[model samples]
Target: MNPRTMHSIFLKKKRTMVAIAMLSVGSISAQTFSDFSYKGNDKIYTNNPLKENEFYSPILQGCYPDPSITRKGDDYYLVNSSFSMFPGVPIFTSKDLVNWKQVGHVLDRPSQLKVEKGGVSQGIYAPDIKYNKYNDTFYMITTQIAGGIGNMVVKTKDPAKGWSEVQKLNFDGIDPAIFFDDNGKAYIVHNDAPPKGTEQYNGHRVIKIWDYDLEKDQVVAGSDKIIVNGGVDLSQKPIWIEGPHIYKKAGKYFLMCAEGGTGGNHSEVIFMSDSAKGPFVPATNNPILTQRYFPKDRRDKVDWAGHADLVETPDGKYYGVFLAIRPNEKGRVNHGRETFILPVDWSGKYPVFENGLVPMKPKLKLPEGVKNKTGKDGFFPNGNFTYIDKLTDKNLDFRWIAMRGPRENFITSAKNGVKVNPMETNIKALAPVSALFHRLQHEDFETSVSLDYKPKSEKELAGITCYQSERFNYVFGITKKDKDFYIVLERTEKGESKLIASEKITLSKAIKLQVIGERDEHQFNYSLDGKNFKNLGGPVSGDILSTDVAGGFTGSLIGLYSTSSNDIKP
Candidate 1:
């Protein structure tokens, strides 16, 4: 909802379309409308009320955090951490940096990403994608934590055609980032333990650099050097010194990192050095960006702002892509960490965030000729337009992700839709489960999928699910008992499953399950006639699936799924 303009209302009821002016914070007058449609209050908004020179924050939404951006010519490419989701490292391209469209995933093939026994939030961590102009190659270096493959690099001349094989790196750390210097030298910077055998504080960490050899596609031996120890301002004891990126600007090397962990105190710090390998010095005003300085307020409380990457526009102006959280409730961030873009201020020695660490600015200025774009919340009609996963489609949608890496034969052709072959492990297990899901783009959206499945025994269950992790999820599935099919709504939290509601019906046909998710609450619905849906249970509080409530680094996913007691082949 842009704060400047008021668009027309498309109402199902003729007399109820009345325009009302609402005064919001930031001294902005917004014209809001309550759009009524069929099925009572369908709670849908038509489109964003766009205003000139006014853009929305959070350029990328819904769990797309730890962003790494690169500019090639007039085109901008962005990628984010996919955590445990298979087909990881979602890639997006933009012409004006305002309107972005997901182009592909870095880990698109089964061989490229294998998350068989990976934990819920353990596969990939903070991937850094860089384009080498001299060699005409794009490189992606990341840490496969749960996969136990450590830091690895993958490259491609044409990103759309997939990347080269994994080049295993011997770096002993997470959040590995590759920096290519102007002198045709490449360096790898990462967060690692503080000098092995030295006792340190809980969050004490160090940033190390290594000469990367692109010719051999490996790291140069005996070139490791500690760049920054104990973060910027070592006396302050800044914890969780991670997410490092090195950039050369105005003949000075700038090292950026996230400090104070990734939660409430998360912040972006800057260090400058004469050489990439030399000792880095902290800026006078260290922690170039942070949200912790803001006074706690009831109206607006945004937290967890850090993990940033910088990209210079064609005009020589710089912009930054960072991660932040929008908590629906106090201490409850349900939407997960999101990526935001803000202008970079370089009047001083070190670059700073133009807007500081403010979560969502009402309006932001864009580059010349670029249109302002905004993100909306509600039951948007075409919000899922890019997702093309159909019942009869042989290939899954690019937006659809599997639990960890998906097996080639997991989903096969069925009568009218795809049949999901359930793995032996359930959702409670630490290993990857048999589930395919799409990102929960909006917290206040309804997702429902109809499946033609009648379980043969209690071992087989299949329906829709709102999953946060292996140990935290809500499922509306149908479990069979001999001749009867039991439609059950279950909740799993911390490896414990509790049935919320259940209904028994004769084994007749497939069941249609639905889950309505709102900012405050959630509800489960089921339909047998395909025209009418009945409430399956009472409203479940939405906080259960939140990152604040269910501690993790990833967001929730809502999609169709199937599972069995034993390995069920499609």
Candidate 2:
């Protein structure tokens, strides 16, 4: 045979081998995706029954952060920070740690603490709730806005009766956790205020446990001891360690806490010691829970993942509850930090974090005999409305809140609509006195308000709006623009206003304006008469409702607002 013919035969054989290898790789990849059944919405399937040892299942949805759970016999009660939302500290009850129901709110009374000036995202910080069986009292501690280091506590025998007046604690810190030792010695563990030098209000990364005296109302036992200051590594400087809680089992003390910033760097760390007050040692494994090492193929990427609490079942199983943020289409975290649950085990001297980096898909078994309850369809029967008396039973839902602290003189009930009296203050400085707001909980929920607006001056703008943040908002109102009574749609950003829509329309002595939001977007529609409607250009892409983006302690709120500096008589 010729030499050139032999070379051609060898080249063809090499091509055939390469094609076979590529086919084998593609077949294996297809099997991997099929085995997981991975899809959107972070849903996973497993053949095993739900037990107390599975990892990676989101327990709650929406911004349910800083979870504090207390197990009372077979029932468990959990509470999270509500921030500026009226009726703060939402309380949820569960039996098997899977299904939960919002039973009531802890901070609803006026004496709880004023949050109007605290701004949106700054009202309440981390809250710790615990029940003292011997005293039959429920105790909760939370930091008040503008108040210094220490937090305030509220106690009540019955959660239905609500909490009592806020009692300020002596310690200067946030994330206050209460622990009652087996010997009946009550102690408080918390993070200390940041020392000067690092980020102001962001340096002290230590967990201190002190004896708490209920009668004296102060922490007295131990001085602030630095437990784990990022393990003496300056490269990881300014690790903001907060949210400390202690758990003891089998004569070993487990101190769990949050570390790093509360954004993408958030994580949970565990320190163990034989004594409560000790030279605690960080687990050699370290960082029991974190997103930095997340698996490559997980459907959801958790940004902020920390602030956890541990709960025990009646049959002696351990579970850890924490919060994390799941990203959305725009690469933004609109859902905020939601609550999650994972089963844990103690192997050797430290708790082994199973499926720590991979999002756990646990098969949760709902507790027997517990029924899921739906949100109230209408307003409370006894709730007093200012403008419209006798609201539909489903009118007043958890979605509603008053801007600033609500005042009695600002609103009242009437036969036609809810009567809102313009207050003698500017909306920018003073909290919107008569503003009634609710969360845009659903991405495509529409909100419309029909009210009689009597603007006393050009400065007084009264109507409805969909606010994204302090820097961005869209409003529809009847205003005196260029000495003409015109219906207009205004867009305000960083306190600067631009008229998006303006037309000469007859302004009634009283007119109604309506605003509708859809698909996490918004549209401005106005009405001079109750019948005719005009569509304003909208559907802008931005955060329709969020705490992180909107710059408030509460979620995206849609409500009625009236702003005026002049005192108007009703």
Candidate models: Cα lDDT each = 0.72, 0.58
Instruction: Identify the candidate with maximal lDDT.
Output: 1
Root-mean-square deviation (CA) per prediction: 12.7, 21.5
- 1-570 in candidate 2: lDDT tens per residue? 432343345435544653454355331111000000001122222233334443224555555678888877777888888765555777877666765666666776545746666555566778888877767677887776633424778877766556676777777767888877676677788886544464433354656677778776567744556555543233557477888888888888888888876766677888888878766777767678877666544554555677888887887767777887655544444445667777666646766555665564443433344332222332111111122223233224343456555423344333444444455453334353545554433333344566555443465656665554444555666545445565656666665666676666665445545555443455677666667877766555446345455554334545466655521111
Listed in order, each prediction's TM-score against the native is: 0.86, 0.74
Which stretch of 10 consecutive residues in model 1 shows the poorest summed lDDT? 29-38
Candidate 1 — what's its lDDT?
A: 0.72
TM-score leader: 1
Q: How many Å off is the CA of 106 in candidate 1? A: 1.0
Q: Give the distance in Å from residue 335's predicted Cα in candidate 2 to where it truly belongs.
A: 4.7
**Candidate 1 to native Cα RMSD, angstroms:** 12.7
TM-score, candidate 2, is 0.74
